[model samples]
Target chain A: MKVTILGCYSATPRTFTNPTSQVLEVRNHLFLIDCGEGTQVQLRKYKIKFSRIKHIFISHLHGDHFFGLPGLISTFRLLGRESELHIYGPKGIKEAVTLFLKLGDSWTNYPLIFHELESKDTELLFEDDSVSVSTIPLDHRVYTNGFLFKEKPAPRKLDVKATTKHNIDRSQFNNIKNGANGKTANGVEVANQKLTLDPPNPKSYAFCSDTAYNETILPLIENVDVLYHESTFLESESRLCQKTKHATAKQAAQIAHKAQVGNLILGHYSTRYKSIDLFKEEALEVFPRVALADDGKSFDI
Target chain B: MKVTILGCYSATPRTFTNPTSQVLEVRNHLFLIDCGEGTQVQLRKYKIKFSRIKHIFISHLHGDHFFGLPGLISTFRLLGRESELHIYGPKGIKEAVTLFLKLGDSWTNYPLIFHELESKDTELLFEDDSVSVSTIPLDHRVYTNGFLFKEKPAPRKLDVKATTKHNIDRSQFNNIKNGANGKTANGVEVANQKLTLDPPNPKSYAFCSDTAYNETILPLIENVDVLYHESTFLESESRLCQKTKHATAKQAAQIAHKAQVGNLILGHYSTRYKSIDLFKEEALEVFPRVALADDGKSFDI
Candidate 1:
């Protein structure tokens, strides 16, 4: 799995800093998360293929999180896209988008599917053979949900040399990989463990933003390979966090430490701060493996 | 009057090219005209004062003309702006913007007034002591209007030397500048024309975009100081212009020639053209005083 940070600042977009938005590439699918204004330009700047994005996940209805959605959809129509686009966002997303489209008289020729989410508890949102997505309800000023994407375990790898040594037929190799005992051409049984090797561990990623420090989401996101959490302020601004329902860098680090994630990526810094290095310094005090999310930065997990 | 081009290209916003949007400063008032996506960033890039903008005029309901409005308004609230902002646009604009605001639950603390228009004829939209704005109906796929900003005639300038020679008292100079005939201290009638000179001609600016070539607007914007008309295509693409309800560079110059404006500014070029100079070259054939609108360019009228 790979993650690309398109923009990672809080509040309004500035000349050098943008609001919250990112792209997650996992299991042959490109998923867009929280499209802020200027996201299409960022996508073009980063050379990301716009047509590859089939699914979009919006954490909340805040302008910083989803204002670019309508323009993106229109661009797709203008580019003559034919594939269906799926949008998963808060309950009122459909009404807002539909009204804008209706006013412009720009109904798309392609299918636009909206999956309005209203649940306040952790629940499964999407699942396929190679990937599964679940929601982690978060505490915020409004209805919000962080998404967890997990890559499903692959089939066991077949040991070609061991199978050949056992004189197993080529057709039986599929059964061996599927965790079945293989029979040799001479009708001798071969142990499945001897014929196959274990596959690599599956990877997982979790995204959380625009929320305050809450312990309820720890379990849902625990033990993930990578965790991205919004750190809107530093430790000095803890009091402001309480008023704004946002998290400080230290709080995000504590959550990462308790969840035992392999790596913690802190983002969504407030525009008031001139330096982002302070956030990394504060997070490193609580979590050893911490990274900062900057616009146009990419990470592999 | 001065005009700043924020973004002049048409259709979707790109990495290098932006959609339709501009800022017009006339008679001590800053007016935002046609805010497309990424306009806020452009405003920041150009270092334009955001708080100075008191009124916004949207040409139509097209996304390229007004998608950035909701985000801009939200940013105003985020920045703690207290001044009331007035928006004038087509009839459905109120519904579209209100729905987006409701979905985000981000009602502005400051006053937001909407002047929704549904007229097909020329009408006065805004007026103050120093300036007045009128709408010029245009032909397009949707309900559209081009704006005409006219600076009111200023008070006659008192020629200091002439006033002193006429023996006009300083106290009576104000009355003379107000276009009143002043009496000398000796009780002699001093002709206002002898003591005062005419102020520089009040300038006017007209903005027409996303419209087809129509002769009706020529009378409304006749003899304006500067006229900005959409030139979405060149003479070679005249057929495409007819089908899309847009005007070519030649068509825009023809309108300028018929209107006899001081200068013609051609913009809203189609992205298919590699060189924007083609538009200027084509427009110059019909109109001698023509300028092409480029992003970040400013013009004095």
Candidate 2:
């Protein structure tokens, strides 16, 4: 799995820094998270294929989170896209997007579906055979949700040498891989473990942003392989975090430390800061493993 | 008056090129015209002060023309703006923008007034002591209106030397500038022409975009100091121009030639083209004075 950060700055987009938007590539699916203003231009700059974005997950209704959605939707129509597009966002998102289309009198030529989310508790959002996605309810000024993506375990691998020694027929290889016992050619029963090996463990990733330091999400994201949390301020601005309902770098690190996540990625730095290194410096004091998310940075997990 | 081209390309915005958006500086007011997707970032790049822009004029409802409006408005609120903002556009704009604000629950702290336009004929939209803005109805796929900005003729310049030679009293200077006869100290009446000189001719600019090759606007824009017209295609692609409701460079020049405009600026080039010089070359074939609009390029009128 790979995660590309198109933009990670807080508030408005500037000439050099962009707002919050990222692409997570997992299980052959590219899911867009929190499309901020100017996201389509950043996508074009990064050379990410526009059509690959089949599903979009919005965290909230803030302009910095979903302002670019309308333009991206309109761009798809202009490009003559015929594939179905799905949007999972806050409850009012459907009305906000469709109203603009209605006002412009330019409806999409393809199927455009919106899944408005209003659940206060963690719930499943999307699922397929290979992967599943659920929400991590977060505490913020408005209703917001972070997504969790996990890979499903695959079938056990066939032990070719063991199967050959047991004289297992090729027809039974499928069943053997499914943890079934096989009858040898000499009429002896072979144990399933003798002909099969365990598959690799599944991996999980959690995305959290634009929230306060709430421990309620710790249970939902505990022990995740990777966790991306928003750190919009530093300790100096901790006084404003409470009123704004944003987290500081130290707070984000403390959450990662308590959750025992394997890897912690910090993003959504306020643009007022002189440098992002301060966030890393502060986060390192609490959590040893930390990565600062920057525009166009890609992380492999 | 000065005009700055923030983005003039047609269709979607690319890495190097932008869509339709410009800043017209006239009479101490920074008027924003047609805010495309990434206009706020472009405004920052161009170093145009945001607070000075009190009025925004949108030509139509196309995404490339006005999609940046919502983000810009939200940014104003984030910046803690207290001044009122006025928007002039098509009828549905008010509902479209207000709905988005309601969805996010992020209404602006300042007053937002929308002047929706539904007229198909020339109509006055704004007037002040020194300037007036009127609409130039155009033919496009949607209800579109181009804008005509005219600087009201300045009061005639007082001929200080002539007034002194004629022994005109200082109290009569105002009357002389207002085209009234001036009285000399000896009670002799002097002609206003002798005491005053004609002020520089009023300058006018007409902005026509996303429209077909229609000649009805010729009367409204005739003898203007400058004209910025959309040229979305070359003569070779004129066939597509009709279907897309856009004009070719040659066609734009034809309108400028027929209107007897002082200078013609051709823009909104299709992204398929390699260079912008072709637009100027094509337009120059029909109009003597032609300039091609490019992103970040500025022109003084």
Candidate 3:
């Protein structure tokens, strides 16, 4: 899994910092998350393939999160995109997006499918043979949902030397990979574990932003390989988190600790601070594994 | 008048280039014209004061023209703006902008007034003591209008030497500047022209973009000091102009020539061209004193 942070600042886009937007690549799919203003330009700066993004997930209806969607959709049309685009966002996103398109009289030639999310409960949003995506309901000023991407367990790998010694028929290779027992040439039953080896462990990532310190999400994101949590402030300003519905670095670290994730990625930094190194410093007090997210930065997990 | 080109390229935003957006400074007012996506960042990069922009004129509803508006408005709110903002655009722009704000439940604290236009004829959109802005109807894919910014003829400057020689009292200075006759010390009436000289010829700038070759705007923009016209294509691609509702550099130059504009500024070049110098080269064929508009470039008119 690879995660690219297109923008990680909070509230507004500026000359040097941008608002929230990221790209998560897993199992051959490039999922765009929270497309803030100027995301298209950032995508260009990062040299990401625009055509490869088939699905976009918006956390909320805030301008910093979804303001770029209309422009992006319009650009796709201008570039003559033929594949359908799927948008998963808040309930009111459809009206907000379609209204502008209608006003401009510039409807897309390609299909635009909006998956409006209003559910307060954790719900499965997408699933395929290799991967699955679901919502992690978050507590924010508005209705918001962070996404959880998890790769499905792969089929068992064949122990070629063990299989050959067992005289397993080549036709039974498929069955063996499916954890089925294979018969030897002497008609003796062989255990499935004797012919097959365990496959590599699956990877997972959870993205949460614009949320307060809420522990209810722990169960939903438990043991994820990487967790990107919003750290809009440090412990010094933890007092402001409640009113703003944002999380401080220490709060995010506490949540990550409770969830027992492999590592925690901190992002959505407020521009008020002089340095983001302070955020990492504050988060380290609660969580041992902490990484800071900056614009144009990428991580491999 | 100083005009800053934030992003003059056509179609979509990209790395190292932008879409349609400009800052026109006239009569101490910083007016934002056609705020395409990424305009706020461009404004910051170009060091234009965001708070000074009280008025924004959107030429059309096309994404390339006005997609950045909502994000900008949101930024104003986040920055705790107290001054009112005025937006002049198409009839449906109000609905399109308000819908997204409503979706996010993020209403501006400052008053946001919209002057929705659906006129096919020239009409004044804003007027003050020093400057007046009006709409110059243009033919484009949608209902569109370019803006005309004119410095209302300033009070004739006092010829200090002549005024003192005519013994014009300081109390009569206002009257003298207003073109009234000044009384001489010997009680002789002095000609107004002798006491006051005409103020620097009123500076005028006409911005016409995203339009086809249309002659209807000639009367509205005739004799303007500067004409910034869209030259989306070159003569080589003039064949595409008819269907795209855009103009070639030659077409823009022809309009500039017929209108007798002081100078023609060509912008909104399609990204298909390798160099914008070709646009200037093509326009100079039909008209002299032509300048090319580039992102981050400024023109003093």
Q: Using lDDT as the measure, which candidate wins?
A: 3
Among these predicted structures, which one has the highest DockQ? 3
- Over A1-301, each residue of candidate 1 has an lDDT whose tens digit, in order, gives 9999999998888887778889999988999999999898889999999899999999999899989989999999999999999999899999888888888889999999999999998778788998988888989888999999999998889999999899999998777887999998779899999998888889999999989999999899899999999999998989998888999999999999999999999999998887999999999999999999999999999
The residue-by-residue lDDT of candidate 2 on B185-284, one tens digit each, is 8899998888888888888999999899999898999999999999999999999977889999999999999999999999999988889899999998
Candidates 1 and 2 compared: the better one by DockQ is 1
Roughly what TM-score does model 3 have, to 2 decimal places? 0.98
Model 3: per-residue Cα lDDT over A36-154, one tens digit each: 99999899899999899999999999999989999999999998999989999989888889989998898999999999999999989889998899999999999999999999998
lDDT of 1 by residue, B1-301 (tens): 9999999998899988889999999979999999999999999999999999989999998889999999999999998999999999999898888888888888999999999999999889899999999999999989999999999989889999987887888998788888889788889998899988888899999999989999999889899999999999999999988778899999999999999999999999999999999999999999999999999999999
Off by over 4 Å in 2: A159-172, A182-190, B167-187
Scoring each candidate complex against the real one, what DockQ results? Answer: 0.82, 0.74, 0.89
Off by over 4 Å in 1: none
Superposition TM-score, candidate 1 onto the true structure: 0.98
Instruction: Quote the lDDT for B57 in model 3.
Output: 97
